[model samples]
Target: MKGRFHEKAPDDIQVFFPNPESEDPMKDEVMWVTVIAHDAASGAFLGILLNAPRHLKDVQEGDNVVFHLPPDAPLPVAVGMGGERLGWPVTAADSLTETVVRGVRHYRQGRFGHNPPGIQACVGTLGHVLEPSPQDAPADLRALGHFVLARCLAEQYETERAIHHFEEVLRLTPEDEYARMGLLAELSVMVHTSPDELKSGTELDWQERYLKQMATALERIKNPHSLELLGVIFSEEEIKNAAESNPERERKLRRIGAGAFRYKVR
Candidate 1:
C-alpha cells in the first residue's frame, strides 16, 4: 500500500494494476495509474492518479510494486522545464539577478513561441527586476532587464510596449547592439503591417530615422544577422551605391551572408 514511484519519464511514472480475481494479470482487466511527483525533498508522498487505458493488460490488484528513493535526495529544481533548457541554476539561494539572466537566456534562445506558461514565467522573473525604479538599477542589469522584457512583449505581439522597453535599453546603454537590432526589427514589422500609417509624413520620418539608426548600428557592430537584415531592408541599388562608397563594408557583408547561408544549409 505504501511505495515510492521512480521517475522514469520527465515528470511522471506509469504503473499498471490488475484485477485481483484475474488469474493472468496481463490478459485480464488492468488499471493504469499515473504518478506525478513534485521535485521536493524526500519522504513526500508521490501524487497518484488513475488513468484509463484503451486496452487492458495483465496486472492484478493487491499487487505490491516497490520503488526506491534515495533517503537524502534533494528537491528537483524546476527552472529549465520549459523553453530551450539553458541549464540555469535554480535554487533557494537564487537571486533576482540570476532569474533575470535565466529569463534573458530563454529569450535569446527563441523559446517563447506558442508557450504561454513559459512566457508568463519569464515575464514574472523579469518583472521582479523592473518593479523598482530602473534608473536606480545598475546599467548592465537595466539594459538586460529591458531587453528581456522587450523580447517577451514582442513574443506576445505587444508591439508598443516592446518598443518602449527596447528604447529604454538603448537609453541605458547607447552601444547596446541587441537593443538597436530589436528596435529595428520591430519597426520593420510595424512598417509592413501598417502601410497607411507609413504613408503619413510623420510615420515615414520615423521609419527613416530608425532605418538610419539601424544602418549606423550595423556599421559599428557588423553582426551577421543584422547585416542580413539590413540587406533585406535596403534596395539593390541602395546597397550597390553604399558598397561602392565602402568596399570593405560590402566585403564583410558578403562574407557574413555566405557564411550564414552555409551554416543554415548545413
Candidate 2:
C-alpha cells in the first residue's frame, strides 16, 4: 500500500500514515512509522511501523516493510501550550516544547533551578536544528523550530534573540498566524512584566518593535490555518494590550479577517 504522506524519507525522518484512509486527516486516527532506511533513487523505504495502523489493514505494530511515501500528509503536529500532538515526536521541535512545559511546571513548584538548565538545554537542542546544514525541513517545521526557540529565548530574557527567531518565522512563512500571535503574547508578557527588555539588536529593522513586527506580519499573512482559531481565546484586553493602541492597524487586522481568516484576534 502506498503511504499517504507527501514527504520523501530522509535519514532520521519518520514516515506518516493516514488513519481511516480518509482525505480528511483531521477526522482519522493517524500513525507514524520510523524509517530504517530510505532509497531516494528508487522512492522506496524500509521501515518498522511505530504504532498499529488504524486504517492500513495489512500493517501491524512493529511490522517491517519496504515502501514509498505517497499522497500528501499533515505537517509535524503543532507543539506548545494547548497544541495537539499525535503519536511519537517526528522532530526536535516537538521534544523541545514538552521540555519547556516540564521546566515550567517544575519551576512553579519551587524547583527554581529547573528554569535555567532547561532553558540552556533547549537552546542547545534548537541551535542544532538550525545552522549551516541541509536537512529536509518543511516550512512548518522550520517556522515551529524558530517559534519555539523564540519563546525559550524570551523566557530567558533574551528579547533580541527571540525577536530574531520570530522574524525568521515571518520571513519563512509570512502567513503563519501562530508565530504572529506568539509575538503578541510575548509582547504582552514583556509589557506587563519587563518592558525594559524591549530593545534593539543586529537583526531585522522590526526586531525591537513588537507592534511593528506584528504589523508587518499582519500585512504579509498569506496562509492562515485552523491553528489561528486559538487566537479567539485571547481576551480583548490581552489582544489590545499586546499591540499598541493603533486604530489603523486594528482596522487592517479586522479587514484581513473579513476577507479570509482562521486567524482572528491576538
Candidate 3:
C-alpha cells in the first residue's frame, strides 16, 4: 500500500489510507494499520492491519512495508495537520480572511503589553497576504489589517513604517477617525523631532512648508485635537497673543483648545 505516515511512531506508525479508485485489491476497504514501532536508529517498519486484512497476520512485527502517497493529494493538509499537532494554530483549512481575522484578534489582545513573537508572526503573515492588494478579501478586512499593522509598527517605534500603513488605512477608509487621529499624532511627532534637522537650510524650508500646510489642514478639520496639535507645531504664543487682539480669531483658537487635555497632561 502506498501512503504517508500521519505522524512519528514509536511502536506503531499510523498511515494515511490510499484512495479507493486505485488498482489496489483492497480499494473498497476503509481499514487502517499501525506499523510496529522500531528503534529511532533503525530504518525498518512493520505494518499491522487494524481491519479486514487478516492474511497480514502472518507478517512479523519487524517486516518492512512500503507506503505511497497519492500524487494528487494536497500537501497543505499534511503540513497544516502537522503544524497543528506541533501546537501552531495555522492550518490549511484556514482561509486568508480567517488568518487575517485571527491576526487582528491576536494584535488587539497583545497590544497593551509586550507582544510575543507568535503574535508578531501572525500579524506579519497577514501583512504579506494582504499587501499589494487584498485580492478577493473584503475591503474592510484589508483596511482593518492596515490599521492594526500601523498600530503595531507605532508601538515598536517604527514611526515611518507606521505612518505609511496609517496612510494606507486612511486611503481605504477616509472616514476612520482613529486612523486620522493616529496620522495626526505621528505628524506631531515628526514636527517635534524636526527642530534639530531644521539647522540644514533645505530641511528648514521643508519643515516650514509642511507646518503651514498641516496648519491649514488642521483648521479645516476644526477638531479640537487637531487644532491643539496645530497650535503646538505652529506658534502657540503668537496665536494666543494675536487672538487677544482679534476677538473673532481669539474665540476660534479658544474653541479649538476647548476640551484639549493632552498638551496640558504632558
- List where candidate 1 sits over 4 angstroms from the true fold: 1-102, 105-110, 128-133, 195-202, 237-266
Compared with the true structure, what per-residue lDDT tens digits does model 3 show for residues 155-184? 665566666777888788876666766665
- Backbone clashes in model 2: 0
Please provide the root mean square deviation of candidate 1 (C-alpha atoms, Å): 14.3
Which of candidates 1 and 2 is the stronger one according to TM-score? 1
* TM-score per model over all chains: 0.47, 0.37, 0.43
Candidate 3 stretches with Cα past 4 Å from truth are 1-94, 116-119, 194-266
lDDT of 1 by residue, 152-218 (tens): 8777776666777888888888887778878766655554444464434455555575557656777
Instruction: Quantify all predictions' global Cα lDDT against the true fold.
Output: 0.51, 0.48, 0.49
* Residue 145 miss distance in model 1 (angstroms): 1.0
Model 2 misplacement above 4 A? 1-116, 131-136, 185-208, 216-266
Using lDDT, rank the candidates from best to worst: 1, 3, 2
**Backbone clash count for every predicted candidate, in the order shown:** 6, 0, 4
For model 2, where is the 10-residue window of minimal lDDT? Answer: 257-266
**What lDDT does candidate 2 reach at residue 93?**
52
